[model samples]
Target: MSAHSWDVRRLPSAEGRSFLVTGGNAGIGYFVAEQLAGTGATVILGSRAPAKASAAARSIGGRVPGARVRHVPLDLADPASIVAGVAALRLESLDAVVCNAGVLLDHPPRRETDNGHELMFATNHLGHFALVSWLAPLLAAAPAARVVTVGSLTAKSVTLDLEDLQSLRDYRPKRAYARSKLAQMLFGFELDRRLRAAGASTSSVVTHPGGALDSLTPSRPVRSRTAGELLRGLPAGLLVQGKEAAAWPAVRAVLDPSVRGGQLWGPRVLGLRGRPVPEPVRGDLADTALAAALWAASADLTGLAPAAAGPAGA
Candidate 1:
């Protein structure tokens, strides 16, 4: 939690491990994949956008010499593609997986994925649910494993309605995203419990970016497309932290020795437009019943329940 220990050099090199990250083509996810690759980890960048995924890998490969980076086509909304992604990965052993893929409040009307789940839920929650579940075998094959699921401060604003988990009933864009994020948090907490119950031996943690002004935010419905003009008068640091700043919570959650299962980490100042800090999140994220319900619903939606049933099996 030291404000001073935030540099990437302090992190342990992934000399003997392999990593996989979702939505890693840009923004915060970009830093996650890049930093890991810089540390000698065999990094895989998973994205629904295939061409962009390749470009991202090439970019990182250029920055970090001999950086082993792989790109996989993944679509959180399409079950077939989710299946295809896992099949394509072909990992014999995986050291860690970061579920960093997510979508924020962008469009006005609610959208559903190919599976008929709400777009937010499918992309942000269930898609990750299936990926981790499908890869559970490879995770167990490793000497040890970790899965970091990215949550958000916006989860604090959510009021979950199980009946409307898909947003079909009542559609407000931001809240829909909030509910999906809340589901992601609940999934992390519940995942730790279930992974343990299954004896998977994988450490699962939840982290948030707080509020890094990465391109991911601008992609949202910008209140003003020319909002960058406002930054002209602001202090340099306040204007926006680069993509790297947003990677703090993910990196900390992934590598920090003291990080406890189900714990949350993010920036300290005003929800992390500043230095990194492990902060408290809503107590409801730790709710067991809700997490279990979410896991069941997610498995049902993504066709991953069978993989998760009865815990990690031999």
Candidate 2:
């Protein structure tokens, strides 16, 4: 609302708080973790690669002196990885978990994860679903713990198809990715509702970074990068904020005390790219039918229960 209010400096000291974030080694996830680390939070940076995850913590520590950053190996594609990551959470109590890792379907040739789930669904949605399920207990144990999951503006572009969740019957990269993201939104909404109904203090909040694309960034949609230059170039128009800016919404979603449970926040402009603004997302993410279906499917995939949420759904 104000020019200087959203600055990271305003974030309270998270000295006693403990947090976990997947994909915190790079991209928008990194920035959110960095912000928390700056506030003295003991942050666990979950990565698919152990070595890379450690390197990211070192990198963050370099930028922010005395930053408490730890690395934990987590690959969303594998349900076992989530199990392992959860077991490795050394903290006696976890204050919050930020599910920041996500993928865009720019490459083709259709892929699938180890669990026989479509690659996009496995990594983007199922992986997160599995992770949250594992970490449910830690969240519930804390009176005001929270989980912040990242969704895409593209979530509105697709609808859930419970019959073909894994895309086993039909597969399209973009559609599958969109479908997974929608699942994330739905999971967050329904998770919040369930937490409340069960009388748990843990809350679920979701947000999107709009579209952050730049010619300088090697990793992004070609259409987006090309369009970035052809349209209006970086940060001006026709493009979303860079990952640095995108990280703001994510950081706020996790650390801001005023943020309410079940609310989705993002940029205020068209396509949600500008400054981080609090707003609910578009679509039926709160749909009970699809949420229940997703919950069951996730349990089946992970062999975990809705009641047995783990430490970190790596």
Candidate 3:
């Protein structure tokens, strides 16, 4: 469908398909899973907390009757957990995997993962890097698979420092978070280039959830917003939107047959609040050299080989 004609309320059918959404138990990820579940597709919620994941799954089931939803234990900051999570999935093939889980620390004392990498960089970029690498074979096994990388608008304002990816030298919370997201966007674009060159059937697409506010979101079993909170969020709602709306870009990227690899999708109005639509990749996001460098660094840090080339539609 054309971008102008695409409708968020009416999604394309995804019957008999399966998708894995990292951090699918809460926030925008939870809504993404809920929306996808409405299409009759099996939605696997990759989360670290079993209780939260179960609650999110029940919420989805209640909202969409007969919706197929399950959870796999996943902690993006831990490589061992990622491996175990992927292993635990029973599916022989996956239609898509949304790299949506991320961390943004507001205040300061820098934190590191057990692996010794910065928390934001490790979880936001490297964790997904490793997960995708491990899931590569399953993605290749599908008729046509998608890897949707969720980026951030914060990335547009900051430049990635390849030498200081972990932010050991200058550890401002926001900047570090932004740079990590920038690195992820670079990885998505670079992965698509490599997939095309290798004739792989899998495609990498990047998307951003413009500006989502929890206060503006509709209530669910997993998260409930009080009337007072909604009232306070009214003014901001004119500019931004709720987390349910934030899931649009990622959902469209996953289900829209016309969406091609290396393309970007996001909120249509001012790239902030409205229907999801195709958006132009700009500035550092379009830099091939930087993407390649980031890809090499990611591979080295994660100790995963570059995505293997396979036959188209393999």
Candidate 4:
């Protein structure tokens, strides 16, 4: 099926299915969880703060009656948190896992995660990589499952440095963030290839919430409301989009049964603010050599098997 034919607003029923969304406390992640929950899907929100997650869950419940929204404390900056978060899921089955948690704010002076990897790389790419690796069995248990890794438009401006995968040599905030996003795009497509080769039913897809701003999120949180006003006051509002609209591509990528593995979706207009559609991937993002190197590096850093990285026992 083509992306032009799909309507993000007309999603299929999600009753009886289960999904896990990282960073579900606020922003586009919260709205994604809200949209899925409104359709009767049970959403497990992975958040770093228990209070925020609980509050987000309560907000979803209030907005969508009978919505099943739960929270698991997930700190992407720490490898231990990822392991604990997976374990906290209690080996339960999942239909999809939206790898949406990311650190967009550029941390100057180069921060490192608990596992000693670059902070942005660790949180944006490696943490999700580990979560998906650990949850492979659960995803395979489902008749059909998907993994949606959120990519970024920033990736188009930078190429990943395989040798300096962690950006340890010269750590510039924006460069590291862009490289990490590129890694996510590469890892996501590579995961699909590996999953297909392994004959697994689970598919891996990537998407970018084009020009989404926290300042425009629709939730009733004080921060969102205040920022929403601030955003409207600025001239950038002409180009920026709300988090709800920005989430359409990701929502489609996750729930659109017609969407295939390795496919990427983004805003149709200017690849920034518009309806969700299939956007062209960067040429270098599809380089097999880089993909392989990234997969190997991810496995080594996360201490998982290279070939058995994705869904198992398909």
Every model: Cα RMSD to truth: 4.1, 4.4, 2.6, 2.5
Q: Return the top candidate by lDDT.
A: 3
lDDT of 3 by residue, 206-282 (tens): 99999999899999999999999999999999899999999999999999999999999999889999998889999
TM-score of each candidate structure, all chains considered together? 0.87, 0.87, 0.97, 0.92
> Model 2: what TM-score?
0.87
Candidate 4 per-residue C-alpha lDDT over 187-241 given as tens digits, one digit per residue, 9 for 90 to 100: 8999999999999999999999889766666646523467557657356557868
Residue 73 in model 2: lDDT? 85
Model 1 score (lDDT): 0.76
Best-to-worst order by lDDT is: 3, 4, 2, 1
For model 4, where is the 10-residue window of minimal lDDT? 305-314
Residue pairs with backbone atoms closer than 3 Å in model 2 (clashes)? 131-313, 133-309, 134-309, 134-310, 135-310
lDDT per residue (tens digit) for residues 1-314 in model 2: 24237665567777878999988877778777877899888999988877767767877787789998998889988888888998898766788888888767776778877657788888887788878887877777776998888888778878888888877766788888888988878888777887878878888898888876544233422112465463555445455566666777778877777887888888768744676777744446657787888877777776665445553232
Is candidate 1 or 3 superior in lDDT? 3
Candidate 2 lDDT trough over 10 residues, lowest sum: 215-224
- Residue 113, model 4: Cα distance from true site in angstroms: 1.8
| Model 4 segments more than 4 A misplaced | 227-237, 306-314
Would you list the C-alpha lDDT of every candidate in the order shown?
0.76, 0.77, 0.93, 0.83
In the predicted model 4, the residue pairs found to clash are none
Provide the lowest-lDDT 10-residue window in model 1.
Answer: 216-225
